[model samples]
Structure formats: C-alpha cells, structure tokens
Target: MLGNVADVAQKEAVAALQKALQSGDVEGAGKAWQQVINSISDKVKTDCEMYNTNQKVLAQRGYRMLTTEETEFYQKLVKAEKESNARQAFTDLITTNGGMPETIIEDVYRELTEEHPLLNKITFQNVKYLTRWILNDHTKQSAAWGNINDEIKQQITSGFKEIEVTLYKLSAYAVIPQDMLDLGPTYLDNYIRTILKEALYVALEKAIICGSGKNEPIGLNRDIHEGVDFNSSTGYPEKTPIKVTSFMPKEYGPVVAKLATTESGRLRTFDEVLLICNQIDYLTKIMPATTVMTAAGTYAKDLFPFPTEVVRSNEVKTGQAILCLPEEYFMGIGGNKDGNIEKDDSTKFIEDARVYKIKMHGNGRPWDNTVAIVLDISALDPAYFVVRNDADVLTA
Candidate 1:
C-alpha cells in the first residue's frame, strides 16, 4: 500500500513540474521542484523504515538492514531528480522562444545547400521592392589634331539608360498534421525545411528559364532575339524561335567572337562566359565523341575557354545553349519585407493541421542585352545576342 501511494505521489509531482514549466511560472516551478524532492525522500524513508523493522524482527536469523547501500541509493536518486528538473527547465526556456533548436537548423541548412548548388552560385542582394542599375551608352570620340584645328569640335554628351527591376514573391507552404509536431524538434524541422527548400528551388529554376519581362526578370531564352536555322530546306515559321536542332564544337569560336563585340564589346575573353544548357543537349549534342577528342590528342573540354553548366529542367529546349557572363547576372532578394515565414493555426480546429507559409521576394536579370547570347546549335549562324532573331542577322 505504501509503494502504490508513493508511485501516485511521484507521478503527481512530475505533472506539477511540467505544468509549472509550461506556464513559465518560476515560483511555481520552485515549489514543484521541492515537492519532487520530498516525494523521492518519502519513498526512500519508507523503504529504510521497512528494512529496519524487518532486520529487527529477523535479528536472530542474521538478517541485516544494509543502511550504507540504502543511503547511497537515496543520494543518487535525489541527484537524478535535480538533474532532470534542470534539463526540463532549460527545454522550457528554449520552447518559449520562437526560434528552433540550433542543431536542427544547422542540419537543415547543410542539407539545403547540398541539394541545390545553384543557390550558392547565384548572387543574392537584399532590398525592399526593387533594384536599379544605370547603363551608360558607348561614348564616341573624334580624332584630335596637334594644332588647334581651324574650328573647335562640338561637345558630345553620353546618355545613360536606367533599368528598374521589381521583385517577385515566390512562396511555398505545407499543412502539417498537429500530431507531427509531437514527433520531436528534429523531425518537425526536417519536414518544414524540406518543403520550403523544394518550393524555393522550383521558383529559382522557373526564373532562370522563362521569367516574364518587368513582372518578373527575363530569362536567358526570352532575352535572346536571334535565331539561326540549321535545316534551311525545312525553314522554321519564325526566323528565331529560340530553338535549334544540333551543336558542333567548330561553331563555338565564331559565336563567342560575335558576342564579344556587342554593346561596345562587353566580353573580353571566352573564359568570362558560361554556357547553360539542358542535360539532354549536353549529353547527346554538346559533348559528342567527335568534339571530345582531337587529332592532336588534346581533350576538347580542356581547350574550351567557357565552362558549361547543365541544368535539368523542362524550361530549356533540347538543342539550345545560353552563353552568359556570370558577372552581369543581377539578383535582388528582399529579406524581411514580404519574405517571411507565417504560421497559420486557425485551421487547427477544423482540419487539425498547422499550415506553415513562407514567402521569398526576389528579382533577377542580365545587366545588359549583351550579357547573354543564345546559340541555336542547328543553325549555320548559331551565335545571337540581340532580341531580333526574326529580323535579319546583324554582321559583326
């Protein structure tokens, strides 16, 4: 009967401690701590008293109390109770804060970066609504004479073009069953972070391929206007539809040279350019056996000045490659404006689920028209930078 009563008392003591911790009642917690200690002491006292009585009753039979062992055990039990209370107090303090546990956050961040390499490669800027840049026109200069020529030349002024880019809000959310939150901090963190990261990556890939002009940023395919036709016999409906049939290594040099001479010559070296294409085009067309090796025994990969970045997406067509200057790609990310994670628990009563919503505001575009060139691999004149593939191709 004493053991059963003591068990009930210990359970009540633990419940009180938990209630105090949840309510953040420091004074109540202290009282609960004392109660827990007293409960454990009572149990130890009862056990010692029963042992003593048994020893006395069986003294002639050589029964002993073993008081030293009982004392050590009681001390150990008290120490364990104190340690458990301290841990519970710390956990309560952390939960009271809106922040997640450090270990969970760290693990989520690591997994996100590993899964999406583009997140690291792309530059991000923090701003409120929009980011702007001033593009200067190319200056024209007249020849100067040693002698103050008969007439003084008129002063020429250079003009500047302003590009204003507005931010686009990308959001992803998940409805988690309320019971899932009870699965511990690490499980909850992983579930939420994984969903959010997947949404972010999806938004990024779309922006890279088909961002709407002004409303969003123009993507590489949309920015290119020049289209070359590889099969002249089967002419395309439009001169430049941002589509092509095949690719060859021999055409790389001439195309790069044409891009280098755009808008007062923006490109200096081929090494400064990046070729972005779909993985299918890269494998079946770009890196063919004929292009991979040369008679001189040099690998084609080593000889190319520009590196290729293969992105897996349905946005990019099968035979198109975008040549770009990484430095000219501008991306602006707004941190605290519309970019925030909102928790919606109003549906808890109806659906028994918590909806976590996150919105990320960002905008990206090429700094100038000459920053990127789309190559229609199938066409003879594969190199194109201007947004006029339907019109006649301009000679460099």
Candidate 2:
C-alpha cells in the first residue's frame, strides 16, 4: 500500500537529508534531491494508476463508485492540505494525548451510549472487537489484559471528550453533513455528536440491509438515533445485518456524496450521479449532476441485481432530483495528508483527471437555512456569513 511505502520513503528521505546537511555535501545533496524528486514523480504516477485500477475493479465487482463531486472534493482536500502545516498539529494531538487509540474508543462509546440509546446497546466487549475490525486486524480475538482498568479507561476516556469538537470538525472533512454536528458545547456533547455521526451511518447501512431485501423479511422499525429501519419485516429473507464491512482509512463516505453539487444554485440532476460513477469525462458545459446520474441510472439497470427500491422518475422536480442525492454526500472528510505520491520514478504512469463541484442550497426561507459543502478549504472566507461562520468541514 502507498501508506506503508511512503512511511519507508519518508524515513530514508529524512536520513539522506540529515546526512547531506551534516556533511555539507552540496553537490551530492543536489543529486540526492533530484533522485528523490524523480522517485516521488514515479510513485505519484503509479498511485494514480492504482487508483484507476481500483475503479475498474469496483466496476467488475459491481459496486457503487465515488461520484464526481466526491472525486473533486477529495482532490481539493489533498491540494489544500499540501498548502497547510496542520498535518503535524493533528499528529501531535493524537500522539501527545496518550498514544493508545483505546482511550478515544472508550470515551467515544461512553458518550454514544449515554446520549444515544441505539448506540447504548453497543457494549465495550463488542466495541474492542470493532476497533480491531477497523484496523483490519480481525484476528485479535480477545481484549487481552482482560480487566478494563478504570484508570487507563478514564484517561483514554478523557482524551475522547477533549477532542470531541476536533473530531467533529475533522469529520466535516469526511464529507458528513454539517447539520449533524450541531450538538452544543461541552466535551460530552461534542463526543456525543461525533459518535452519533458514525452510529447514524451504521443506521443508514442497516436501512440498506433492509432495503436490499436480503437479510430477513424486510420490516420497518425505529432505530435508536430516530432513523427508520427496514429490517427483516420489510421483506428480504436472507440479508445479513447491515454493518460496516470495512473502515475507510479516513472518512470518505459523506464527501463522496458531495461531488454531485454544482452551479450557483447548486442544483444536481440524476444523470450527473451516474456519470460520476462511470468516470466519464466531459466538457465543463456538461452539468456534473446530469452526467453522474445518467451513468448511475444505466449502471443500475444492468448491475443492480438485488431487489432494491430507488425512486426514479422524470416527473420529480429539479429540486427533488437534486434532493435524491444523500445529504451526507455534502459533508467533507478531513485529516488527510498526502504521503508523498511522486517520491521516485523512472517510468511514466497514469494521471487522473478529477473534478470538484459545490452547490449551496439556500432554503431562502431563513438566512441561516442554507446547506453548504465544506470540502478542503479550512481557510475561512468570511464575506458570506454562511461561508465564514461555517465549520472547517468541507472545501474544494
């Protein structure tokens, strides 16, 4: 993986630079710099190719792909991060606060259960496993060192509350809707909101399980977070419980959804969603929403093999069409730092053409009733109250 490769390269680069600076090898250092730059360029090209290949694999596997809005927002995020020094800030916080990730995990769970019953059902035992699951180390069967020491748990828990707002703000970068992060001040509240975002996402997946009609007889029920669930009673006879099968390295779920928004009015059409999934590039004249939705529609007809009900009708107003895309899609992902894509290269590689689109929906009813996408532009633009006062969640 690129992350692992980058870690190794970073170590070598630092060592070489340190040596050059110490030895005063001006000429040798210059050559080293060129070598490193070439290596980086090659890596970047390979990374792009890998990304493209992943897209092809997704297509072959019949999975939904990121929308154009998602692709663009992610690109913008990467670009913006390159311009900032916040990466170290985040790293320092995580490291200084007791490097054990469990502290955050426990506190996150505590806040979730206390405020949200749906999450309250999630016990500590299962949560430890879930953490491991996220780490992609499912083989960790036991939370060894069995007893949950109160002191350790408390310290870890403390870290969770302290970073709640930071986590929430960070999640804004994950492309989650800003409305969801509106819990009032206080570490507990912030923590609660952060937990709610993930819990609700799980809720959504549960809905998909019910909607897929695969788990049990699809049934309707109220989820803990107040989301309606389509469970066994609703219809499917053989669907597995909806759960996150994989933890995205960083939150990309919501940001992927935002990629469909475009224009001043920020309108999106069904076709645009489809075009984005297919990776078809078109002139700027082509509305992104139209391109994406059109492609998705065609793909759905041939690829959607299961029984699922997605409302599709031309009679729906443009506003309604725009509304069809999940609100979560408008949220942005954060805490992403490029791990040096082009570290070294002697061969040419593919470069991806990415597009980003932001659409603001002003409820126009109340001045504050506006929906904005905060892709990767953390540097605030205060002229517009909506733009200025908004959280540093989405940019592009």
Candidate 3:
C-alpha cells in the first residue's frame, strides 16, 4: 500500500512538473521537480530500510542506493564518458559486475502505449531484431462450398507482402544534465523515458500517417497498391485527397464508407474509426463542425455519422484529415534490450550535460489503400444551434 501511494505521489509530481514546464513557469517547474526527486529519494530510502539488514547487500550491489563515495564514483563515471581512462575504468567495472540486467522490451513499449492514445489504437508488435513481417495483403479469399476441383483452386488467388523490418532504424537522443545524476537512477529513468516518449511519439506518428516511403515507412496518405496494374506510379503513389465541402453526415459519411472495404473488395469489421488531423484544423474545423448542443443544455463533441475518435497532431498539414479503421494499420517496433544505453559521443554538451543515443528497430504501414481516406476539410462548415419545434428537431 505504501509503495502504491509513493508511486501515485511520484506520478503526480511528474505531471505537475510537466504542466509547469509547458506553461513556462520556471519557478513552479523547479518546485515540482524538487518534489519528484524527493519522492524518488524517499522510495529508494524506504526500500533500503525495508530489512535494515539488507541495506548492506543492496549497497554492495550498487543499485542506486549508494554510499557517499559510491555517489561520487557515479558522478565520475558520467563525467568520464568523454575521457578514455574513465570510460575504461567504468567499462572494467561493468565487465567485473557481469554486464547489465536485461530489461523486458515490452515494458518500454507499455510506457509508450500507456502515455499516448494513438499508439494504443494501432497494432503494436514488439518483434525481434531482423524479423521479417509477413503481411497477408488483406486480399479476399473465401472458401467455396465444394473445393474438390483443381481448376477452381487454381482460379482463387491471394497475395502477401514481405517486409524486412531490419531496414528501418529509429534513432533518438536525450540530453542529461550533470545535476540530474544527484537524483540517482530512479529519477534518471523517468527523465530519459519522458524525453524518449515525446520524441518517438512525434516521429512515429508522422511517419505512420504520411511519411515519404523512400527510406522510411509508407503511410496512410500514400497509395498502398502501386505494384498493381491499375496504379502506374513506380514509387509509393501519392493519393489524391477527397474533397469535402462540409462535415454534415450526408457530405462525409459516403466518403468514409468507401474506406470500409479492402483492396480485394473484402469488408473490414469496425466499431470505432480514427480521424487524424492537424492540431489547428482539429480546433478550427473538426471541433466546430462536430460539436453540438445537447438536450441537457450542454455541449457534446465529435458526433459524426459513424463512431469516430479524433486524434490531433501538429505534424499533419492544415485543411486535411485522415479517416480510417486504425486496426488496419500495423506497427512493429522493438530492440535487443534497454540494458545497453550508451553515451552518444565520448564528449560533453558544453552545458554541463551529455546526450545519450538509443537505437530502435521498427517498421509500420497501413494494411491497404482501403485503410484510410485523405480528406479536405478546408471548407467544413461550423454548425450553428438551430431552433425547431417538430418531432426530433434541432433546438437552441
């Protein structure tokens, strides 16, 4: 119970710190961060004092709850990452300690999905290194009543695409200030995780939506059927945006319905769909069009002809929205282990800080061209409260 309480407090402090930093309240941020660090320290101290006799064992293991000399040694290691002799000393220490603990890759994935809504929506596969992604191209192949005829079996055809996930590499860097080492590994983990979350979130979501398929993952905005005889584009084809004059059910429903079938004309089952748009467009266009006054004298939003969840992003362009069945998109990302966090360079950032680089192997793409529709909501009409007295009528 106490551990759970401490976790809640630490989370609250971290949230407060984020709020302060986002609002540019430096003083508030400092205070909130101090609280977060205090919570971390308290937790470490509590764990150390749990058995009282186990403190010595934990200290001998050097698991964050270090003595003053051990603390100084850690500081030395951080500074020495730039120096050959210091790095060698630390490397020898690790070699003697039997290397690093292998952290479960799924835990890292859990942190990302738990924090971001869009990440949780699509398919997230934590695949092994160099794993080949076998995608059955959503092609329709229904079993016939009596498949005894060899000619009938020959007529039925299906296709699958093989993707080499090793071709995709996601690299990101996080800057760690020298002062942060005072908080120990507990807080440092949180800091680096926070940095990685935001950085990876922006990069991954952008690529999944409209990334140029040159060296990156192909996205929803591109035609997924380039190799077919119907599509002439050699490279990933750029999809022509379907125009929309308004967000009325009659105007938008048909366009969205067109995305309900596979490239092979198979129907996809869905209860909820996703609407991804530029942050500005979401506020200026989507919200204004979807929001309506309720009978209880309140406002309800995102009310569409279909069950739709809107995702806002700054990466997408203005006047455009991508609507799709999110389940039709597959994203696979994982790495060897989180145990090998290394210094980006054997140098300092000159700001009493250093940058650490993490390597991730990943790939992503929509299942087919039927997965999403690029929409032009540039001229979407802002709904107004209308008054009427007939049965099932709009009222102010």
Off by over 4 Å in 3: 1-84, 89-105, 146-161, 164-166, 228-237, 336-340, 344-346, 385-396
lDDT of each: 0.50, 0.27, 0.65
In model 1, which runs have C-alpha deviations exceeding 4 angstroms?
1-114, 117-119, 129-162, 184-186, 224-250, 262-272, 289-312, 345-351, 378-396
- Model 2 / residue 117 / CA error / Å: 4.0
Question: lDDT (0-100) at residue 143 of candidate 3?
Answer: 61
Q: Give a tens-digit lDDT track for model 2, residues 1-396.
A: 763575367346534643463366877755554444334433333444454446565344222334444334333334333445534533343344322223333444454446433223222222111111121111112222536554433222111101011111111111212222221112112222232334333322233212222331111111211133535544322212222111132332443344344322243433312111101111211122122223223311211112112322111112211112232121111221221011111122122211111111100000011112212211212121112222333442
C-alpha lDDT of residue 276 in model 2: 13
lDDT of 1 at 251: 53
Better of 2 and 3 by lDDT: 3
Q: How high is each candidate's TM-score?
A: 0.52, 0.19, 0.69
Pairs in steric clash, model 1: 225-387, 225-388, 225-389, 226-389, 230-378
CA displacement after TM-score superposition, residue 84 of candidate 3 (Å): 7.7
Q: Of the candidates shown, which would achieve the greatest lDDT relative to the real structure? A: 3
Q: What is the C-alpha RMSD of each candidate to the true structure, in Å?
A: 22.2, 26.3, 8.7
Clash pairs, candidate 3, are none
